[model samples]
Target: MKGLYLALAALLVAVNCEAKEPPTQVVYRFDDHRSLELKGWDCDGELWYTDTQKGIHSQVWSQFYRIFTKKFIHPSERYMAISSWGGGFTVSKDYGKTWSGAHYSPGENEPNGDNRPPYDDILSFTVVGDQGFLQTKHRLYMSSKPFDDPRILPGGPGIHYELEDGVKGDIQSGSAGWAWGLIYMTRQGLKGTIQELQTSWKDLPDKTPEVKGYTGWDHMRCDMDLGK
Candidate 1:
């Protein structure tokens, strides 16, 4: 009886430890080095932030696990990656309710992305996404999705994406009063500003206009590792 109890105790301990262990997928998923974060959904921000699946992780995930984030985040279909530049296009088909993590890569043949992405400066681009309106230097040029070439938007030195109603996500929501993708310059350097855009079922014209000071390309740079 004592021997049996010991064996059962060891098994229970092993099982508990296994349950507590972080899966291999999680190990890969949490390796986030980007400044911008994709959030709001229930996956605990893991889809955008980590390579790890919630549980059922693996060294080489199965097909189901392979596109798990892509599937769960179903971005392009609903959300639009409203950016002033290339990387870090957060689209939400659900109308600011939730964000779709689906993303677009500049691919192999782009102005700054031909074999070398326009600067390896992929943001989720908190590096460039600043607050000033139509600041060109901060504006980046990498073809957006569905476009084979990179496109340029008027903004600051760093890149910023603007998610609005009826872009690609077909979401009918608003950013409220907070404008999406407005980065505030700080001691830490340029970062992506996150604000809720006002969503309206009907179109609201720009009633009033204002100017805000934001960083510009005067501070633009490329990732040395992924030399542009």
Candidate 2:
């Protein structure tokens, strides 16, 4: 009887230990010095993270972020990433018990995304199921990935008639899940031309007096460090 009681006590202790275990963490750093993290947490189809006080947190509305990324954590649910202090990010698949992977927000993720040039501090997004839009440091991209992972939008469809006969432009779309009218380095109050998705430079509009970049912008629900 004594041995049986000891076994029960041990089992209870083990369960308690598991319940109190801390969450995992993931962080990212960018050349632009914008960094962020993701702590595995969730709430109401949204991602929960740690704030300045280091307390667990979640967004008042994560659906808006769904337009871009699917990594939002739900309340009290097991997540693989979370946010951090001093405005950074982190990630961990094991729920904050441990963590790995970091990145700089609005950093370059080229040869894998759209034609718009690289930009920074992309923190706002909106997604609906498999269709959504993402606003990063430079510009917005489109995708149809799971709520946990979304892809970038492609360029418009057609040819640059002004160019050589056989030359072609990138595939751009206006679909909701894959439609992003705004782009990086675009001159405010002026419109720029869309070339191939692989080009690096853009011709400024005639009326604009030197285009400004990332002027007066902010976002939420992104890893911040690695998410951009």
TM-scores for all candidates? 0.24, 0.26
The C-alpha local distance difference test score for the whole of candidate 1 amounts to 0.26
Per-residue lDDT, model 1, residue 211, is 21
For residues 1-228, could you state the per-residue lDDT of candidate 2 as single tens digits?
999999999999889866763332323221132223333333113333333333434332232112223222122222232333222233433323444433332323343533343324444433222222334555444321222111123443432234355655433334322122112222321122332222322332222122123321123333333311
On lDDT, the leading prediction is: 2
**Quick one: best TM-score, which candidate?**
2
Superposed by TM-score, candidate 1 places the C-alpha of residue 164 at a distance from the truth, in angstroms, of: 33
Write one digit per residue (lDDT tens) for candidate 1, span 1-228: 999999999999889865652322221211122112222122122222222222221112111212111101112222223332332344333323345333322232233434323323432221111211111222322211221111121221222345554333221223221123322111111112121111211121112123234222222222222211
Whole-model Cα lDDT per candidate? 0.26, 0.32
User: Can you tell me which runs of candidate 1 are displaced by over 4 Å?
Assistant: 1-7, 18-90, 93-95, 98-101, 105-124, 127-228
Per-prediction backbone clash count: 46, 55
Superposition TM-score, candidate 1 onto the true structure: 0.24
